[model samples]
Target chain A: MAFFRSHVLVCVDPECLARGAHDVIDALQDELVDQGLIDEIQVLETSRIGGCEDGPEMIVYPEGVHYVGFNADDVPFIVEEHFLKGRIVEKFREMPKVVVDEELGPLRPKEVRIVLKNCGYIDPTNIEDYLAVDGYQALGKALFEMTPEQVIEEVKNSGLRGRGGAGFPAGRKWDLTRQVNDFPKYMVCNADEGDPGAFMNRRVLEGDPHSVLEGMIIGAYAVGASYGYVYCRAEYPIAVETFNIAIAQAREFGFLGENILGTDFSFDLEVRVGAGAFVCGEETALIASIMGLRGEPSPRPPFPSVKGVWGKPTNNNNVETYSNVPQIILKGAPWYASMGTERSKGTKTFAVGGNVKKPGLIEVPMGITLREIIFDVAGGMHEGRHFKAVQTGGPMGGCLTEQHLDLPLDYEALTQAGSMMGSGGLVIMDETSCMVDIARFFMDFTQAESCGKCTPCRVGTRRLLELLQKICEGFGEDGDIEKLEELCEEITKNSLCGLGQGAPNPVVSTLKHFRHEYEAHIYEKRCPSKVCRPLIRFEITDPACTGCTVCARNCPVEAISGERRQLHHIDQETCIRCGICVQVCNFNAITVE
Target chain B: MTAPSTERDIPALVRAAIEKHGAKRDALIPILSEVNLALGYIPGEAFKEVRKQLHDPTEGVFVAESQLHALASFYDMLATKPRGEHVIKFCENAPCHVVGGKAVWDTLREKLSLKNGETTPDGKWTLVTTSCIGLCSVGPVVLVDEDLYGNVTPEQIGDILGRYE
Candidate 1:
């Protein structure tokens, strides 16, 4: 093997690639060759660095120096000044280099990472890279040292529950499968991470595919299963590709095929990609979809553990839940149990995004408060915007207000606060976000995603959406509030699956916290946040206006009229309330009413 | 999208797809996905071919063409009608919708001269609304074919779409 002085890791994640990180890689390589330092320095591309906002960023290893916001144009300077001359490039330096540590220094993790340990640290496509970081040690320990029942006992002691929204105990699920008398049992990894704001599963599958595979293998052993399937969404092309490579590599290493490591236990794994169905995230629906059906959820009487995929006894766990198993086996139950709260043990990974300062995949301890997650971990709201509310989970989750920020974020606490932990999607909203519109937004998602098998979810979601639509359009009647509440209660009580049961959460929670906003939309015919176009209007203040004609020129509907060095006015009759003038205006002259 | 190949021109191709993944009754979705990927859209003749290939008289298991068509229409990714040369899937979920997605949606409609699920008259582009593509932090996300564009602003709509054709 060849030894290199430094490793140049350029981020080529979707965010950075969109920002021209590929060009930067090419330019850096070309510059290194031009300077005759190509052989001396190794150039490589990696996944997301967690600093997605300052992407097209790279770090030089051994020195651990980070360079941010540099383009292809600055590559020659970087090669000459840093790689050749051996001097730090102060112009592009994002942060001071610290002594090398196991954790990510450049990204500066706000919380400990257990589920996301291998992500961004190892190359997902190469199994050897995963092996270097003690990849299969847990599986080895589980297979050789501990018996199948002992493995389940350790998990039960650790109190590790499912991270896939339902919060069921993972050990209990495995025990149920182990007790069931069946031949050719199965284990499944639910990589169908369909939550709109969550991509932690995508990151894990793309950055450390073997970790999930190793976790799945360990899980299969504990449950007495002979076969396993990893059902991933086809939307994540890179994740699927990486996982397939990991599976092939594992099989080659004698870790996946029949009689792994020459033991009596023989197991095999295959990949089943979903066809763009959100409801498939539900375990039963996912099983049905894997069986080549319409991906509809059947009511849970005999849970998936008792009778699952293909009408056989099966154990199904989400991507994050499976990713936690290996660490528990390797480190022991006490080490894993020492981190989190009383009931919810260990860390939970969340995909934090929206109007936050730092938006990326994060893993925090289970009991971390929403305030700490939003302000401390995510660096607070963007541009110092006032904290309005934060929406966790997905379409099924509810929006929490400022008063709920101090509440510890766990399955029980969030559910008690009128929201569920869901699949760990923390989307922060600023003052500009309207609660009524937010409810409408979630209603639209559930209404469309509802499979037609259940009438309550299918028809009730449509009716709730219609009521929300009427309210947002300034056509809400006097009795609309009572009617909405009645419908919300009825839907929550009568729905068949989790999709329908949780569909009313957004409206119910928003009404609990921000009913005044909804009242304004209904009675006063106004959007308090000025987000609903039909309820809001735009006008240019004369004092703030410089008569730049920027808004007038850029208006899609040509609704604004003004002259040079004069005031501008918006024709309400012609204005579609698209809010283009507000975005285009440089002088901050336009105000929403 | 694949090349504009008719059903009659690709019987061998259709038969090969069915042979590769049509052994089980549940292979209906994967078979449709493979055929759509190869022939752009699931043609009526291709459905008939899938039915014929899956019709195992000895096994007492036969897949109907109506079942294949129902599976095709149920999933958003599978389209019975051709979606032109390029397909654009815009995230219309709440996360994207709250973060100024409506403006970008309107701009796309105006620029492409088509609404959701409508293909252009020139057969150059098809616009559709998707629930979410899982990049919620950067709202107003657009996926053109396999490429994902995040935090898409209304002003960048024209330049982004121009790269397709």
Candidate 2:
């Protein structure tokens, strides 16, 4: 085997792949082979890099110098200057140091980065890369050094709650199954990250699959489970593929399969790819899907810990929750407990997205304020747009406004503020966003995903959607607000599972925080943000009109009129309200009011 | 539409899918997914064949046809009806909508002359709205078959759809 002094690790994650990183990689490899430098320098492709905004970025190892935003043309220069000559390419150093704030600076580390430590560093497909970083050592330690009881005790002491939104203590869940006395207890790693805006779990599975595997192995040992299944959604093909490879590699390394690491304990895992269904993220629904049945959540009391997959006791934990287990085991429980708040322990990974300047996956210690996450970690709202609200926790979650920005983010605090810490999907919204539309959007999602097992969820969600749709379409009645409030309460109280019970969160929270916007939509027949098509109209303001004819030319339905060098008029009669004219108007003449 | 002869031949295809999974009841979703991959949609004949295979008294575990159809109809990826060659899944969730998804959605519908969940008359494209594909950072996203197009604008919709055919 040939060894190289330096490695060129490129970013080929989803975002980077979308940005033509593959072509740049192809160019880099061709250049390297042409220069006869393949033996001297090893080229590797790592995952997300976290700094997705400055994509197609790569690092030349030994120096640890990162070059950002490079294309095919810049590769030959980097290879010649950095690899061939022993000098760093100064011109290609577009990304400021990891600490220093660059142009899109919030990608910097205000984060503790426990969960995301290996994400941007290692090649996910290669187990050797994972091993080099002390990957399976946690599982080895748990299997050999500590007793199963000791491992469970450590987890209990750590206060590591479930990151899958419910915030149930991981140790307590395992203990529940351990005491069940059921044979063949199963451990399922819920990689079905169904929360729309959240890709934190996806990144963990794609960038560091083995860490989750190691975590699952430790959980299996602690909970006395012999078989495990990873239920990953089929939409995330990359995550599914990477996890399968990790499973295969671990089996080969003797970390999985019978008598792992020369121990009496035996555990094996297989991947059960989920067909498209959002509700399958629920533990019961997930178990049903794994059983090749319709993914539907049954009532609780008899949780998965009591009777789960194939009628055996099962312990299901979120990917992030499981990923944290290995770290909690490797480092002592107290060490893990020391990072987070009094109640919610350790770090939380959030897929920070939407209108943020530098949106990407970030892991920060608990008790970090939302303001800090938005402004310090994510660089605030993009394009100087004023902050409206940040929607966390997907369909089951609510939106928090500027007033709640300084609130410490943890399970209890968020719940107290009327939102749950639901899988940590923080979607930053700017002033352009309409709270009514946002509420309706989440309603639409839950309504579609409702499994129809319960009347309240299946029927109530449709009614809530109807009310929301009525408000958005300028048909909101006098008693619409009261009707909505009553429906929200009824749905929350009567729903069978989390999907229905938490379905009204978007509406309730929007009513609490952005009530004035809702009132405007209902009473005045006006969308405060002008997002509702029926409530707003695009008009050419004469003072700002340059008569450029750009709006007229770009109108999808020929709604704008008037000749070049003359004030144009928007023909509302013909307009489809597609917003193409507003987008194409160069003179700042178009206004939606 | 499949010919009557082709409909008769579905049992062989269904048997191949059943044989792949050893006719286990727990492998029903995988079988349906495999059959959906082989045939464009899980036809009524395919489900009947799967039901027959599942009830094989020797090796197969019993699974009712009602249960199979219920499982099949529940999943968004599985379709009972015939679909177009290319499936265009547009993200219609809040994050995508917040970042100009409505304009792109409008353009797509107008250009294709089809509403959401409607396939083109020529059977070239099936437009459907998905909740999220977990790439919300680059919002207003759409997936044509396997290829994902992110940060999609109304103008880019034409070029993106153009590449599909």
Candidate 3:
């Protein structure tokens, strides 16, 4: 039992948490504990393993074998046969098993792995799993070994920008606060992520809370601050739970409280729950919310770095930004700066969602192409459906057409293509989708979540919504399209915070890419994709329907009527457009015309 | 009770909440949400109990009703087998009612023979609509205990409730 061999580590990040990490953890623990070989067998639950499209992910430590999208039912065989009995779990393994010559250690012929080395290979919740792969060694180095100026200098050299979408220099932001004429300054981790389809913060917080905490402590040292705050959304109970646990554990381990690592520097962190406000994601509004004011935006001359959070010099970074701090401290700046594109350095985390073959969180080098993600990494669109456009940057982000699929996803490139890497929310859409409707859908989301503090965002977005409604409802005016462009410009220029400024991007980009579809909606009263109910009609193909009685019985509006063994016809006028009939019908008879 | 005339001091506002309703965790949700809206987050000492000054031990008055529900029959999930004293679930999604989900829900209310969000005199059942229950697919879905009932119907509603009790 004490005889040593190789080890296997699997990441159980929450995204994959649902996919089957719990069972994996349970199995690994049980198997090891049962034989009393628990001390010899090392299993880790690291952060998300990044095979969202094909993952209930696992990794083999010492050997570095990766299996993507595996089920725990496959674990026993993997442990007994692959690890112990000397056989591989072929069905569960992610890629083709490479055979080693027995002389050379098992090595991948061609595959690059960084930024996610610890992901899926260690237990993120356990500090020991993190430390086994050398987690807090970075904090120990930065705090006990390096000077504050040197820590800042190393980060300045890393070229890691704020992953919260703005891509500001992480080191410089710390440096500014460090040089500022302020005492009792604060370092904050911005976990109040409100994007509709984004959960990167949740993953980092739940899977690797210590990363962000370690980052914050280093940031506090660099900024000459004594306190840190993690403003997380109260909606995310799991994230909050893990963060609370991480904080208590870190403090208990002598990492977060006064004089960390036996140094004179003292730093403490507190978790503030946000009452589900979307606008509070904005830095200024977040400060206001923390200051016991409504989470509303105010004009800024005093940025948070200058006079923020109780009017003190504060360094605020997204959850991902904080997660990177321990890395830079451990790996050194040059190592961190080595990855990613020129302007946007290091790997970026993307919540790849929607109509893609693989819809989950992925962390790749900054300049990775959308084509590579969708076709290669994400395993292409689901069913090979004609890939239309991908919407990056949440509701406020713009949609890029198929032509731009090859575009590198850097901060500047995405913005130039009509979407910034706003919090890295990538919602991929397919051919069956209507771009006009997609634009309207995102606009409706933003309008509802808008704080309504400024006129342009408040009123202009409403007017724009009314216009999109007019277009979608088949009542668009001839000049309406031009006015939408005008309104977008006005709203962007006049709105107070980033929400209003970027709210119009969805409309503008969709219009730019799919204007002909809008023209069809106006001139021909036709929905090119035939998706809009008002512009299309459902008909039972005479030859296909066998009068099964399913459609006739299921229609909410009683739109269909048919006798047994007779053809069914839809009463168009009575139809409420519910489409229940279509869904209930197993036949190919129902067609939208 | 009605948000303090649109402008009030923080503690006075909390006191006003206490006047309308006693300090309690069950009371905490509505009172805290309102207070947080008026002022971001509950103040440091806001958790302190509010004492009622209007009625002394010498005299007593009838308790105030929350009146959260205008039409009780509209809530179907409330009518099911009365589990606890009340049914409290928030709707955190869209299109619950747009597809006549609300109307279908109302049928459950009528079947349960109760008004919106009212407990039976036995203090057994109270049904209420919420902001958005996140499971949109099964939406207009009701969560009774840990179980989620999706695409609910009035006829089937009673059968599910029978098991809960």
lDDT of each: 0.85, 0.87, 0.71
Highest lDDT scorer: 2
For candidate 1, list the clashing residue pairs, or say none.
none
Best-to-worst DockQ order: 2, 1, 3
Better of 1 and 3 by TM-score: 1
lDDT of 3 by residue, A317-406 (tens): 988887787877887787877887888877877666556554556677888899987777655776757788888887788989889988
User: What are the candidates' individual DockQ scores?
Assistant: 0.55, 0.60, 0.07
How does each model score on TM-score?
0.87, 0.86, 0.71
For model 2 the TM-score comes to 0.86
Maximum-TM-score candidate: 1
Q: Estimate, for each residue in B1-165, the C-alpha lDDT of model 3 and write its tens digit.
A: 113335646568767765554544223333544554454334333333222322234543221222212111111211212333435342422223322254456555765667655556765555555433323323356755446676565456778778757
lDDT of 3: 0.71
Candidate 1 wrongly placed segments (more than 4 Å) = A1-109, A546-548, B6-8
Instruction: Supply every candidate's count of residue pairs whose N, Cα or C atoms clash at under 3 angstroms.
Output: 0, 0, 26
